[model samples]
Structures are given as C-alpha cells and as structure tokens.
Target chain A: MILARGLRKSFGDFEAVKGIDVDVRRGESFGFLGPNGAGKSSTMRMVAAVSPISGGELHILGMDPADDGPSIRARIGVCPQEDTLDTELTVRDNLYVYGRYFGLPRKEVRARVDELLEFVQLTEKADAMVEDLSGGMKRRLTIARSLINRPDVLLLDEPTTGLDPQARHVVWDRLFRLKQQGVTIVLTTHYMDEAEQLCDRLVVMDKGLIVAEGSPLTLIREHSTREVAELRFGVAPDGDSHEALAEKIADLGHRVEVLPDRLLVYSDDGEEVIARVHERGLEPVAVLVRRSTLEDVFLRLTGRTLVD
Target chain B: MALDQRADDQRAGSTAPTSTIAGAARLFDYWAIAYRRTWKGSAISSFVTPLLYVLAMGVLLGGFIKGDPTRLEGATSYLAFVAPGMVAAQAMTTVFGEVTYPVMGMIKWHKAYFGMTATPLSVPAVVLAHLGFVLFRVGTTCAVFLLVMAPFGVFASVTGVVAAFFVQLLIGLAFATPIYAFSAGLKDESAFSLVFRLGMMPLFLFSGAFFPITNLDPWMAALARATPLWHGVDLTRMLTLDRLDWSMVAVHVAYLAVLALAGWFWAVRRLSRRMIS
Candidate 1:
C-alpha cells in the first residue's frame, strides 16, 4: 500500500531522514522501530504525504505523494504523535467534524460518529468535553477520529507512548481487531514489546538509517542467540569484577557481555550455560534464563538501548 | 465498498473533498457549530461594546461637539457623523481580534489546523474557512451596531445602511487576511502584543474613525488615508450621511479590494509553508 526508495527529509542544514527504502504491503501490520531520533516519525510523515520529501520516490496506493497528496490523504488515516484533538468540542463533535473534513454528509457523519464512539468504547463520554477526558480516553478518541472515513491504510505514530500498561493493552486490543479486519497498519514505536506484539514486520533504525529489517522473531534469531543467561554477583571480591567474571565464563557460552551490574551469557542452552557457571565455583547473587527478544536484537545492532 | 463510495462521492463533484468551496464551507461548519455554543461570549464585543462606544464617544462626547457645527464634517449631528465611523472601526477591531491570538492558538496550541490538513482538506481551504468565519462575525457585529445606532437618528438612508454593512465585511477581510498571514508566520505570540500596541492601536486612534482625516496635520492625514480603516471609515460615513461621491467611493472600494486580495494570497502562501513542511 505504501512504497519509498532513497527517501530523504532535510530541515535547512540537518537531514532528519537519510536515504532509506520501505515497502508496506496491504492488510499487514508494519512497524518502524528505533530510538527517539531515528527518523521514524519523519519517514511516517513522508508516507502520510504531510511532509514533503527532499529527495526520494514515494507512492501511496500507486499515486505519487508530491502530486496527489490530497487524494492520497483522502484514502488513509493518520494518528499523529501529538494529541491534536479539538479541545473546544465534545468527543462526538470531534469525530463528527473530522468526518466532515473528508466531505462526508451530515447524516453520514452523525451515524459514523455514533458508531466510532462505540468502537473506541467512548459512547458514554461522547457528549463530554475533550479536555475532561483522561489521557487514555483522549488517545482513543484520536484513534476514532482517524478512522472516521474508513480509511484503507492507517498510520499511527507512537500510538501508545505515554499510556499506562492497562491503557496500552486496551489500545493494542483495538489495533489488533483492526488488523484482523484487513486494514493495513503502519506504526512507529520505540518499545520493543509493542513492536513484537503488533508488527508482523519491522525495521530497526538508528541515526536516520535502517540497520536491519525483518519480522520480530527473525531479527531476534539473526542477531541474537535463542536464549540468554543473566548472572549477577554480589559486590565483586577484590579484583573479581564483572569483566573478569565474564572472562571466566566466556567459554561456557557463544559470547559473554559484561555490564556494570550483571554478566550476560548468550547460548542456545541457557540451562547448560548456568550449570557451567556454577561448575566454575562463581557464587552469584542472581541468575535468570530467558528467551531473547527484539530488545536483544536492537542492542546487538546499535549497541544502544531503544528508549535511551 | 468504502472505496467505491469515496469514488462516487468524488465524481459527484459538489462534496467537500472534491470541491474547494465545498471543502472550505465544510471546514467553516466546524467554527459555526463552535460559535453556537460560544456565541454568548461574544455578545459583549458584538452588541454591548459597540453600543457603548457609540453612546460614550458619539452621544455624550458629541453632545458638546454638536455646538460647533463647522467641525462636524457637514453632518446634521455629531452622533450621525461618528456613529458610522465607529461601525467601520468596530469591523477593523473585530476582524483583528479574531485573527490575532486565536489564529496563533489554532496553529500552536490547539493544532486544529493540523488536524484539518490530515484529512482531505488543503491549507487554502483551512485559510478560506477561517477568513469566512471572520467575515461572518464582522457582518453581524456591524449590522447590530447599525441597527442600535439607527434609533438615535444616525442613519439618513436605509439603503446606505445596507451598503455600509457590505463595506464592513470588506474591511473585515482586508484586515483579517493580512493579520492571519502575520499570525501564521509567528513562532510565539509575544509579537502579537506588538501588533496590537503598535500596529492596531495607532490605526484605531488616527484612522479618521472619530474625526475627519482633514482635521489632522498634512502628514498624519496622509498616513490615515493610506490605511484600510480610514477607507472603511470614510466609505461608511459617506454612505450613512447620504453623501455619494462616486469617484471617491470607487477609490476606497478598489483600495480595500486590492489590500484584501494581496493579503489573501500572502496568507495562503504563509499557511502552505507552515503546513506542508
């Protein structure tokens, strides 16, 4: 539904989005995973046809964004990173007026507003002022407003950035239902678990460049081992630091990484690695064996945590 | 099925998304609905404020000035002369008031315009809708002001009052479009106070609204004549007093029209830059 090649965005002297390529298929859940300044929002804006690309080729639904921006925008829904909800109107009017912007007739918009209020689980608050809504409720109202026109593709930028865990789960559930209904979803997020839970395919970006692109499991498999063993020792005995401890158990696993507080041993068999660590007579304070995640893949590629 | 409906709507060619005027009107619908809820807030400005200005500036003050008829600009009464100028000045103030801080709030605080652009509406449509709303406000305010002043023997001709109403709309657009352009380009609202304190207040005081420009020194009179409010004031005064100078009328109309057109284009350019990037 969306395609880009060598896409670039520059604000005067600084380029936010360096050359990159992306292709999002119809009815698929796609994500852009990166740190705060990884050009994910810039790329999303270009695809949404709201930001003009400095140099690139982009086609949304087979139409060039530069020439057919209004037409392309007519067919897609965009939930921007900021809460741009109209503070002057009620929740129902927010949806109603937004539908009118797409040229929906008054009756049609009224009907759609009621249905969307129900879809976002905001029917009870439909008549309430927008400012009175909680953060999660406002976010849901924005999502409802974006879907007023029944857009073919939905673009969500940082969909759940500031929501509580329960609220995030609520939003994720609504989005998953949308995915099941065959609406193409494009989202950008810094949370590894959000990407893993929502995106069928994703790209890891850093410093305005895409470093790796694959499904979540595939990326973890390609960049990280099947399992990891985390071991924490009590304040290291003199000269027995994390680095030294890592060196001692380095041969027990495929690789050993020394952190300030813990030592990570990568291996296909976390149980065997833990056994070997005990065999070495290193009395550790804590040990955990867990499967690798997209967080691990991102760390392996960028050498920096996603949130930081 | 939804795509099919959208295609049919586009082909129909009169809906908001497919037509510029329709789209802008649809966007304007938002403000209209909002106004329904908030119209009471503006009652003071639209009705009470203008009424009070005419009562205080024209009636009470003009009571002393009517004794000196030579300086009353050939009008039969002081209330008659200053009333229409108040209407014109009120239009200017109303339009400026609507476009300045509210325009900034739309762009920076509420992000309402950004939300409109995310849909099928274009930047020009948003600008047009907002300016149209300003025109509506100026029209109603001027109409109410004229009505309230008529009982006091201010208007000489009923048709002239109608013409003055239309001129007030032009005056509103002439100020609104340019102020909108200025407000759209601002990063913060600190400059807006400068606009009011320096730009608008000076024009309101010396723009032939209370007295004739000819009463001023030559340089200041020329400065007053150069402003849109002076043209609006002169045109409105001439119409309400039943003195139709076709030549001067054409000049005033053409000047305000040119200013409105120029500001319209500049506003569109400024808004496009802010929104598209």
Candidate 2:
C-alpha cells in the first residue's frame, strides 16, 4: 500500500530523515521504532502526505504523493503525535466535522460518528467538551476522528506515548480490534514492548538511518542470545568495577556486558551461567535469569537504550 | 474488510467532492457547527453593542450637533450622517475580532488547520472556508446594526440600504483576508495589540465616521482617504444618503476589490507554507 525509495526530508540545513527505503504491505501492521530524535516522526509525516519530501520516490496506493496528496490523504487516516482535537466543539462534533472535510454526506457522517464513538468506547462522553477529557480519552477521540472516513490505511505516530498502563492497554485493545478488521496500521513508538505487541514487522531507526529490520523474535535471535543472566555483587555496589567482575565471569557465558549497577551475561542457558557464577564463590547481592527480548536486541544494535 | 474491498467501497462512495468550491463549503461546515454552540456569546456584541453605540453617540451626542446641519456634509441630521459610518466601522471591528486571536489560536494553539489538512481538504480550501466564516460574521453584525437603526429614519432609500449591506461585507473581507494571513504567520498574539491600537483605532476615529474628514487638516484628510476603512465609510455614507456618484462608486468598489483579491492570494500562499511544509 505504501512504498518509498531513498526518501529524504530536510528542514533548512538539518536533515531529519536521510535517504531511507520502506515498504508497507496492505493489511499488515508495520512500525518504526527509535529514540526521540531518530527521524521516525519525520518518516511518518512524509507517508501521511502532509510533509513534502525533499528527495525520493514515494507511491501511496499507486499515486505519487507530490502529484496526488489530496487523493492519497482521502484514503488514509492520520493520528498525529500531538492531539489536534478541536477544542472549540463537543466530542461528537469533532468527529462529525472531520468527516465533512472529506466531503462525506451529512447523514453518512452522522452515522459514522456514532459508530466510531462506540468503537473507541467513548459513547458516554459524546456531548462532553474536549477539554474535559483525560489524556487517554483525548487520544482515543483523535483515533476515532481519524477513522471517521473509513480510511484504508491508518497512520498512528506515538500512539500510546503518554498514556498510563491501563489506558495504554485500552488503546492497544482498540488497535488490535482494528487490525482484526483488516485495517493496515503504520505506527511509530519508542517502547520496545509496544513494538513487540503491535507490529508484525518493524525497522529500528537511529540518527536518521535504519539500523535493523525484522520481526521482534527474529531480531532478538539475530542480534541477541536466547537468554540472559543479570548479577549484582555487594563488593562493588555501583561503579565501573563491574568490568573486573565481567572479566572474572568472562568464560561463564557467550558475552558479558558491564553496567554501573550490574553485569548482564548473555548465553543460551541462563541457569547454567548462574550455576557457574555460584561455583566461582562470588556472593552476588542479586541474580536473575530471564529470556532475552527486543530491548536486548536494540541495545545490541544501537549501543543505547530505546527510551533514553 | 480487506484492503481491496475497502478501496472498492471508497470508490463506490464518492469519497471526495469533485470541485474546489464544494470542498471549501464542506470545510466551512466546521465553523457553522461551532457557531451553533457559541452564537449566544456574541449576541451582546452583535445586537446590544450596536444599539448602545447609536443611543450614546448618534442619538444623545447628535442633539448637540444637530444645531448646525451645514457642517454635516449633506446629511439631514447627525444621526443620518453617523449611522452608516458606524455600520462601516462595526464591520472593521467585527472582522478583526473574527480574524486576529482566533486565527492565531488555530495556527498555534488548537491546530485546527492541521486537523483539516490531514483530511482531503487542501490549504486553499481551509483559507477560503475561514474567510467565508468571517464574511458571514460581518454580514450578521452589520445587518443587525442596520435593522436597529431603521426606526430612526437614517436610511434614505431601501436600495441604498441594500447596497450598503454588500459594501459592508466587502469592507470586512478587505480587512479580514490580509490580517488573516498576518495572524497565520505569527507565533504568538503579542503583535495583535499593536494591530488594534496602532492600526485599527486610528482608522476608526479619523475615517470621517463621526465628523467629516473635510474638517481635519489637509494632510490628515489625505491620510484618512488613503485608508481602506475611510473608503468603506465614505461609500456607506453616500449609499445611505442616496447620494450616488457613479465615478466615485466605481473607484471605492475597485479599491476594496483589489485589496480583497490580493489578500486572498497572500493568505493562500502563507497558509500553504505554514501547513503543507
């Protein structure tokens, strides 16, 4: 449904999105995962057909964005990173007027407004002012407004960035239902767990470049080990001295990453690595054996965590 | 539905309006819907405020000025001379009220323009929709003021009243469109104070709305003549008095029309730069 070859976006002298290629198939959930300044939003803006591409070839539904922006926009739904809900109108009116902007008939828009309010579970707040809504409710209203036209593709930027845990789950449930309904979803997020939960395939971006692309499990397998053992010793509570401890347990696992508070030992067998550590007579303060996740893969690829 | 089924359904639904005017009118529905909720807030300013102006300035103050009709510039009474100018000046204030802070809020605070453009609406369509709302506001406020003043016998003929009504709309657009462009380009509304104080206030007082411009100094009269509001005031005054001069009417109409056209293009260009890029 969307294709980009060497897509570029530059603001004055600073390039937010350097040349990058992307392909998003119809009815698939795709994602861009990165830190705050990793150009994920810039890439989404180009695909939204709102921002002009500096250089590249982009085709959305077999039409060039430059030549057919309005046409392309008509088929796609966009949830911007910031909530741009109309504060001047009631919650139902926000959805009602947005549908009219797409030239929907008044009766059709009215029907869709009620259906979408129900879909997003905001029917009770239909007449409430937008400013009265909580952050998560506002976000849901924005999502509902975006879907008012029954768009073929939905673009959500940082869909659940500021929501609390329960609210995030609610948003995720609605998005999952949309996916089950066969809507193509494109989203960007800094949370690895969000990417793992929602994206069927994803690309990790850093400093305007894509560093890796794969499904969550495949990425974890290729860039990280099957399991990990975290150990913290009382002798060196928090310092660079973890490097010495890492050297002591060097042969215990495939690799050891030294952190200020602890040491992470990557290996296929976390219990075996923990047993070897005990045999060495190192009375560590804590030890944990856990399966590796996409967080580990991102750390291995970018040398930095996803959120910070 | 799957992607292909959805695309086919959209094709069958007549997804977007075929013409630019249709798109803009559809977008205009937003303002109309919003106004339905808040029209009461503006009722005092639209109806009561103009009544008070006529009572205080045209009726009470005219008692003193009624002693001399010679300085009234062909007007039979002070009420007759000042009522049309009040209508014209009211258009100026109404247009500024619609365009300044609200336009800033749309661009910076609420981002309503961004919301509209995210749909099938283009930037030009958004601009047209907003200015169309401004014109509506100007029409309603001026129409109320005209209706209120009709009992006072200020209008010379019904045709003049009708002509003045259209001129009021044109005057509002002439001031509103360019200011709409200016407000869209701003980051904050701090500069709007200067627009009201330095730009609008002077034109309101010196544009022959109260006294004749011929009573002012020659340089001041020339400066007043140069303002868009002055042309509006003069045209409205002539129309209400049934004093028709074909040549001056052409010049005033042409002047306001050129400004409105130029402002329309400027608003479209500036808004596109801000929203599309």
Give per-model TM-scores. 0.95, 0.96
Candidate 1 residues lying further than 4 Å off, grouped into runs, are A233-241, A258-261, B1-16, B67-70
Once superposed on the true structure, which residue ranges of model 2 sit more than 4 Å away at CA?
A232-240, A259-261, A281-284, B1-3, B67-70
Ten contiguous residues minimizing lDDT sum, candidate 1 chain A: A236-245
Q: Which candidate number would show the highest DockQ if scored against the true structure?
A: 2
Check candidate 1 and list the clashing pairs: none
10 residues in a row with least lDDT, candidate 1 chain B: B7-16
The DockQ values of the predictions, listed in order, are 0.52, 0.66
TM-score, A chain, model 1: 0.96
What interface RMSD does each of the candidate structures achieve?
A: 3.4, 1.7
Q: A223-301 in candidate 2: lDDT tens per residue?
A: 9999999998776446337777789999988888876667889999999999998998886789999999887887888
lDDT of 1 by residue, B1-277 (tens): 7865654453332123666676797786698778888799886667888778887988789878854556666678878888888899889988888999988888999999999998878888899999988998998888889888889987889999999999999999889989999999989999988989999899999998888788999999998899999999999988998888999999999999999999999999998898888
